[model samples]
Target: MIWLVIILLLLSILLYLLLVPIIVVIDTINNTYYLELKGLAKASVIEDNIEVLKIKMRILFFKFYMYPLKKMAIKKSKKTKVLKPKNERFINSKNLKRVLRVIKSFNIKKFYMNLDTGDYAANAKLYPVFSFLNFYKATNCNVNFVGENNVQLIIQNRPVRIIKSFINL
Candidate 1:
C-alpha cells in the first residue's frame, strides 16, 4: 500500500544517484580542478593564501572549506596509538588488469595536452602520436619544441560502473 509506494520512491532515487555520472575536470593552464556530482555536490581546490591551499566543497546550499594541512597536524597531535591493519594490496599482472578495467570505465569527455621534451628530436617523435589523437573530437593533443607544458582533461564515470568493477573482483 503506502509503504510499498514509499519504498519504490526511495529505490528510484537511489538508482538515479548510482547511475548519474560524476565528472572530474582538471585544467593546469587555467589552474582549475574540481569534482562534481551534477547538481548535488562539488569540491574544488582553491587558494586563499599565497602559501596554503584549501579544498572548498559545496553541497546543496552549504559551503565548506577544508584545510588539508590543519587536519594532518591535528591527527599528529593525538597520542592514540591505533594499529592499522596491514594492507594486502600488491601490484601484480592480475591486479594491474583490474585497475586498468576500472580506469577504462571512465569516459573521456575532453582531453587536451601540449608537451615539450626540450630536445627537438624527442618532440618530433611524440608529435605524430599526439597528432593521431587529434582525430577524435574529444581530444586536442599537440607537442611543442618551445619548452611549454600544459594539460587539460575531463573524464566522467558512474558509481555503478565503479562498483561493478570491484564487485567482479
Candidate 2:
C-alpha cells in the first residue's frame, strides 16, 4: 500500500544517486580544485589567505567551510612508544596494478596543460614528448619557451562503475 510506494520511491532515488557521476575538476590556471557530485554537492579548495587554504563544501542551499591548515594549541603530554603490527600488508606490484586499473576507469572530460621549464634546452627536449602524448591522448600538452605553467583537467566516474571496479579487484 502506502508503505510499498514509499519504499519503491526511496529505491529509485538510491539507484539514481548511484548512477550519477562524480566529477573532479582541477584548474591550476585559476587555482581551483573541486569535487562535484552532480546536482547534489560540491567541495572545493579555496585560499583563505596567502599561506592558508580551506575546504568549502556546498550541498543544495547550505554551504560550509573547513580550515584544515589552521593551527591548534597543543598541551605537553607524555610520549608513548608505538609498536608495529605483525600482520601489516604492504602494497605490492599486483595491488598497485589493481589500484591503477580502478583509476583508469574514470573518463577524462577535458585535459589541457602548458609547461615551461625555464631552460630552453629542457623545453626543446620536452617538445617531442609533449607532441607524442598529444597525438595519442585526448589532451592538449604543450611545452612553452615563455614563463607559463597552466593546467586544467576534468574527470568523472559513476559510483556504480567504481564499485564494480572494486568488486573485480
Candidate 3:
C-alpha cells in the first residue's frame, strides 16, 4: 500500500512540473498590464526577467518576483531639464539628416528618449537611411524646418526577433 502511495505522489509531482511552463505562458500573455499614456507615454514589448521564468509555479506571483523592472514613471522622476540647453541648437532638416546619417552608419539598433516631465517617451525607429531622407524632403520644405516648423519624421520598420532562426518554421 505504501509503495502505491509513493508512486502516486511521484506521478502527481511530475504532472505539476509539466504544467508549470504552460501556466507561465498563460500568465504572461493574459495578465500583462499595459498602462498606456498616449499623449504622455506608452510602452510596448516589455521584457521579463529570466529568473521569474525559472520561478516555481507557486511563488511566481509574489511581489519580490516583480521587482527590478526598468520603468520611467512620471511621479517618481525628479530630474528637471534646463529648458533647452545652450549647445543644443534647434533641429533643422539638413542638420537632422546629418545626425541620422551618422546614427545609421553606426547601425544603432535601438533609440529611446523620455521627456523631462517624465510623462512621455518617444520610441523612434529608423531603417534604410537614403529612402528616409528622400521621404523627409518630399513631405517638407527643402530650405527651413521639415514640417510645421518642427521636423516631424516617422519611420516604420518591422520588429526584429533574434531567436526566429532557432524556431522551426
Candidate 4:
C-alpha cells in the first residue's frame, strides 16, 4: 500500500510536468492570434481612411489645379506658346490623380518619403509636399524619411509583419 501511494504521487508529478509545456504553447498561440487580429483591424481602418482622404485630395486638385489649367490651355489656343516644358504641362491634376490611382491599386502596405533633395521649394511647392506627408502620416501608415537624395520609397507587401516581428523585443 505504501509503494502504491508513492507510485501514484510520481505519476501525478510526471503528468503535471508534461502538461505545463502544452499549456504554455497554447497560451502563446492564443496571444499571437489575438495580436494578428488586432493588426488586421488596424490595417483595415487605415485603408478606409486613406481611401476617403484620397477622394478629398482629388476633389481639391480638380477645383484648384485642373480646372484652371484647362481654362489657361483654352485661352492660349494653338498659337500662343505656354512656354512650359512638355513634362511640366503633363504634371497636372489628372496626372496626379493617375499617380494616386496607381499607388492605391498597388495596395501599398508601407510608405516612406525620401525628401533629402537639396532643392528648396517656395511656399507653393512646400505646402503640397508638407500636406502630402501629413496626409500619409495621418493614415497610420509608416513613413521613413531617408536622408539620401536619390533614395525613393519602396513598398513591400509583407513589410508590416517583418517590421512588427523585428521590433518585438
Best by TM-score: 2
Which residue pairs come into collision in candidate 3?
Answer: none
Taking all chains together, each candidate's TM-score versus the true structure is: 0.79, 0.88, 0.21, 0.21
Question: What is the per-residue lDDT of model 2 for residues 67-129, given as tens digits with 9 covering 90 to 100?
Answer: 887778988779877987878569888788789878988999999999999999999999999
Clashes of each: 0, 0, 0, 0
Residues 61-144 of candidate 4: C-alpha lDDT, one tens digit per residue: 232211211223335456765675555574788667655554443233333333434444433355466677767563221222
Clashing pairs in 1: none
lDDT of each: 0.88, 0.92, 0.34, 0.36
Question: What does candidate 3's lDDT look like per residue over 1-169, in tens digits?
Answer: 9999999999986655433221101112234323222222222333455533222112333322233343546585588767855785689776666655433432222222211222222112222332365465443212221221122333322112212222323
Q: Evaluate residue 87 in candidate 4 and report its C-alpha lDDT on the 0 to 100 scale.
A: 50
Cα displacement (Å) at residue 117, model 4: 3.5
Runs of candidate 4 exceeding 4 Å displacement: 1-105, 122-124, 136-147, 150-169
Candidate 1 accuracy as TM-score = 0.79
lDDT of 2: 0.92
